[model samples]
Each structure stands twice: as C-alpha cells, then as structure tokens.
Target: MAGITRRKRRSTTRPAAAPVTPVADLIRRDFTAPAPGLRMVGDITCLPTFEGWLYLATVIDLHTREIVGHAMAEHMRTDLVCDAIDLAAARGFINDDAVFHSDRGVQYTSGQFRAALAEQKIRASVGRVGSCYDNAVAEAFFATLKTEIGATIWRTRSQARQDVFTYLHYYNHTRLHSTIGHNTPAETRTNHYHQASAA
Candidate 1:
C-alpha cells in the first residue's frame, strides 16, 4: 500500500470577541433619562439597494427617543459607529459622563470605539449577549423605520441615502412618538429645556 495523507479541514467558525474592558449594563432595561443627553442608545442597520447595502449607525437620545447622531456608509466598520458618535458629540447632543448603551456588536466593543467614547467623555454601556430585550428601544426604532420607509429596495445607494436623510428629519421633527406622550422628539427636547429654564 502506498503511503497517503488526507488534508485536515480548517474550522470556519470564529470565537466571540470580548470587550476590550469591563463595561456594565448601565441602562439595565430602563431606557429612560431624567433629561436629554443623560442616557442614549445606538445601533446599526442596513438598507437594501441595487448598488449594494447601505449601512446606517444611529445614536438615539433615551429621553426623547431622538436620533441625535447618525452616519451612513457601505461598510459597518468601527469607523462608521465612531463617526456616528462623533456626530452626536459635535452637535453638542451628548453630555459629559452620559451613558451610551449598545448591543455587544464587534464595532461597539472594539478598542477604537471605546477610545472614541472616552474622547467624548461618554461612558460605555453594553447589553447582555443574545438578549434582544436588553436593547429593545434601539431595536424597536429600526422596526418602525423600515415599516414607515415603505421601501423594499432602492435603485441605488445614493437614492437610499437621500431617502434616509429625509426620513431622519421627519422622524425627529415631525413624527409623533407615543413614548413621549405623542410629542415629536424635537418637541420633547425643546419642551424639557424650556420648562427647565422657566423653573
């Protein structure tokens, strides 16, 4: 018999990556804040297009349910999430020591994202693994968005981007939210600030 060897099959699965540092479940299923810029949640979603998928990262204010920051791109890389956070921060929507909660996505758990949060003086909060309830608010937001957008697919990414831009504006300034007593997110924020100043 001639000596022969068979090749070993390589494993296709990869291990789950842990967070760079210990982060707590700060939100703890209580997706509420006494005021704006105190607690926030963020998540990423994809839009279908003939050109390809358009990825969107959004930072939502917990109190008002407003998408204070967002970024869209063709890739769901760490930079995409960071850019979202940067936008939120640059707009002065995030306050120092504000808790930003997200699911345990790779981009959210990456060191680069942690550094970005640190740079903005925002504390990082992560939901429990495999628990959709842990991040329900952000999850629900996407569900509402896709349902309201009423588009199965777009002709191009550019078209998708434009529509998303239009949608975000409507969501923030026009759409009524039952969570905030049927007030728009912008209205909720403004009302809170106006009441605070008057008091």
Candidate 2:
C-alpha cells in the first residue's frame, strides 16, 4: 500500500480593528434636504454579466432626484468616480460649496478623487462603513433601476455599456418618480425653474 500524507488546515482568524467613527460624522454632517445643485449623492453598484460583473458609479442631484452624471467601468477604481464627477462638473453641477456624499469606499477616499473635488471647491462626505441607510437615496435609485430595467446577464462590456446608457436616458427623461410627485427628473427640474421664474 502507498503511504498517504495529511496536511493541517490553518485558521482564518484576523485581527479586529477599532471602528471608524469619522464616517458616521461625515454622513450626519452631509445629510440634508435637497437644494438645487448644492448637494449630490453618489454610489457604485454591481450588475451581473456572463463575462463579468459591470460596475456603475452614479451622481444624482437630491433636489430633483436626477442622475446628473454616471460612469461605467470594468474596475471600480477612483477613476470610475472621477469620471462621474467630471461629467457632473462639465454639466455645470459643481458650484461653490457643493457637497458630494458617498460611502466610505476606498474609491471615494482616493487622493485623486478628493483632489478633483477640492479643485472644484466641493466638499466630500463619506457614509459610515456597513451602513447603507446613510446612502439610502442612491441605493433606492439603484433599486428602481434594477426593477425597471429588468436584470439581464450581459455577454460583453460593450453590451452592458449600451444598455446602461439607454436606461439612464430613460431614467432621466422618462421614468416617473413617486417622491417627486410622479414627474420625471427632467420634468421636475424644468417645472421647478419655471415656477421659480413665475414667482
């Protein structure tokens, strides 16, 4: 008979570090009712695909609940968020004292991402770790996206990109939000501006 050897399994225990309290403070400081272009919420979410999961980073204006900017990337790097921020800035979303709020994900805390905000005079607010309630608005938008778009496994990144873009256009200009009184984001913003002018 041949000799058999056995190997010992190693424990997967890890050290527990002190809780990060700054994240909670940041969330509390940033959470507020929406004012046009003054506050924005952002987050990244994953979508399944046959090739791999697609990551989407989105920035939405809390006033109209409009997804003002977004980016899709194969990697959830800082650049993914930077791209969204750049898009929002290009669309004139960045004004003095604007605040960009997101979870304490490393991507959001990266130097490059922070630098961009600093350059635009925008403040960065990070939500507490493991607390999704801090970013509930962004999460709710993602849920609405998944529900209305109908999840599908993408065969390629390009396909996912196209589908996401199409859905975003519809989301901004067509899909009605109950919170905004069943008005699309675009419509809500327009109506707001018109009412302000009339008043």
Candidate 3:
C-alpha cells in the first residue's frame, strides 16, 4: 500500500471551433471621431510578475486619444473588458450609440460582452480575423504602453498594477501625443470642450 501509485488520467482533446462571424467593422480603420464620446477602441494586454500574469483592459477615446477607462485583473475574461467599458460609461465618457472597436478576440465576441455593450448603448465593432491593422489604434496604445512603462517584469501583480495606474495618469495628463499636435490627452479634451463652449 505504501508503494501504490495512481494511474494518470487520459487527456481529452476538443474539436476545432468553427469560424466566428464577427461583428461589423464599423471603424473601417478610420480610428477617429468628431467628438470624444462618439468612438472608442479597447484591447487587452498582459503584464508579467513573479506572482503570475496581470491583465489590463483599456477603453480609449478616439478623438482625444485618451484612455478613458481601464481595468486590471489576474484573468482576461469577458468580465475584465466589460468592467473597463462600465468604468468609461460610469465616468460619463461614453455617449449613447457610441461605437467600441476591438479585435475579434473571444472576450470581445462572447455574448456576455456584447450584452454588456448593448446595456451601455454602445455599438460593437470587430476587426477581421488575424488582421492586426484592423485594430491599429488599440494595438498602438499597447505598444506605446509597453515602450513607455519600461517594466519588463515586476515582483508582484500589485506592483505591476500600481505602475500601470501611474502610467495611465501620466499618459493622459502629461505625455504629449504627436498625432494630436503634441498635446496631452487631457489637454486635448479640455481644449475641445473649451472651444465648443465658446462657440
């Protein structure tokens, strides 16, 4: 009895999934909107830490190039993206019938996330399969984050989350964006509202 060994369980393989019919590509690579709340793009990226992986989901406003909302967690579930959208909506950053563009990731395509967007009155837009260019704005944001955050790894997820929080604030309020005439996202947004009010 002391030397007895348990048999290894056989692993089962799942059948390949069918091709997903993605949501319409409403963006068409335009990646721009006349106003802040009309259009947005979101994507998820992973951060490495000794504890494990920390996942971040971000919702960015197209007009000001501002990261309006973001959520960080240990998992990349639909809830993570939904939480990001909810934050944007809660902050009054998303407009009625606004469009949210994302790649055809399962989390973005899943019924739960679509329902969340519908609840928020946000239209869902997805890129074609395997086409990174279709969601270039979101991809560029993550790339810039990786480059500017300058953290290859962290000792813990808490540290990673704190660093990301700081970076997002700096990105919105301090860092200048060349696409927006070298203005910070916060400044661009403020200027837009100021101009509109004066008009």
Scored by lDDT, the top model is 1
Residue range 1-199, candidate 2, lDDT tens digits: 1112322322111222343323223447344445567888898887666676678999998878888889998877789889998899899865677888987677776677878888878888876767778788888888777666754566677777887898899998998888889999889888877998999
Best of the two (1, 3) by TM-score = 1
Q: Which regions in candidate 3 have their CA more than 4 angstroms from the true location?
A: 1-22
Q: Would you give me the overall lDDT of model 3? A: 0.85
Pitting candidate 1 against candidate 2, the one with the higher lDDT is: 1
Per-model RMSD to reference = 10.4, 9.7, 8.9
* lDDT against the true structure, each candidate: 0.87, 0.75, 0.85
Following a full C-alpha superposition, what root-mean-square deviation does model 3 have from the true structure?
8.9
- Which ten-residue region of model 2 has the weakest summed lDDT? 6-15
Clashes of each: 0, 0, 0
lDDT by residue (tens digit), candidate 1, 121-167: 99999988778799899888888887787775777888888888999
What RMSD does model 1 have? 10.4
Per-residue alpha-carbon lDDT of candidate 3 for residues 1-199, written as tens digits (9 for 90 to 100)? 0112223322111121342554799999998899889999998888777787788999999999999999999988889999999999999999999999988777888888889999999999987877879889988898888777877777788888888999999999999999899999999999999999999
Compute each candidate's TM-score over C-alphas. 0.91, 0.83, 0.89
User: Could you give me the TM-score of model 3 versus the true structure?
Assistant: 0.89
Q: Which stretches of candidate 1 lie above 4 Å from their native place? A: 1-16
